[model samples]
Target: MNAQELRDKTPDQLRDELANLKKEAFNLRFQQATGQLENPARLRSVRRDAARVKTILNEQAAKAAE
Candidate 1:
């Protein structure tokens, strides 16, 4: 998921996406701990995506407040 795509979504959608990303991140960590993670890159990607979503959410909230 890209920032542009995330920006196009509503706040509710963004929240949903963030939740899913966090869940995936947790699963990835579990796989790593279990020694079964196939793609290490995915863990990094999910973390970044979650951060991107958070940034966008903050930006939107700031806009709403102004």
Candidate 2:
């Protein structure tokens, strides 16, 4: 997903997306630990997606506070 897509989502939706991303990241890490991870790049993408969701949430919060 991209920033524009995330920006269009409600905060609650974004939170849900973040939670899913975190879960995926955790699973990716587990697979890596077990030497079963097929695509190592997926772990990095999931981490970045989670960060993007977080940044958007923070931006919304700051906007609301203003």
Candidate 3:
């Protein structure tokens, strides 16, 4: 997903997406270990997306706390 799409998600949705991304990253790692992964670049993309979700989530949380 693009940054715009990620930014459009609600906090709860972002959290859910983060969880799902992490799960996908784990599976991708497993696939790489077994030489089944087609595109290794996906790992980097997933990690970056996960980080973006987390950063947005944290920003929202901080705003709420203020």
Task: List per-prediction Cα lDDT, in the order shown.
Answer: 0.97, 0.97, 0.93
Instruction: Give the TM-score (vs. native) of candidate 1.
Output: 0.98
lDDT of 3 by residue, 1-66 (tens): 787887788998998999999999999999999999999999999999999999888888899999
What is the Cα-based lDDT of residue 50 in candidate 2? Answer: 95
- Candidate 1 per-residue lDDT, tens place, 1-66, comes to 888999999999999999999999999999999999999999999999999999999999999999
Give lDDT: candidate 2, residue 26. Answer: 93
Q: Tell me, by TM-score, which candidate is best.
A: 2
CA deviation > 4 Å runs, candidate 1: none
Local lDDT at 8 for model 1:
97
Q: How does model 1 fare in lDDT? A: 0.97
Off by over 4 Å in 2: none
Give the higher-lDDT candidate: 1 or 3: 1
Using Cα atoms with residue i matched to residue i, what is each candidate's TM-score against the true structure?
Answer: 0.98, 0.98, 0.92
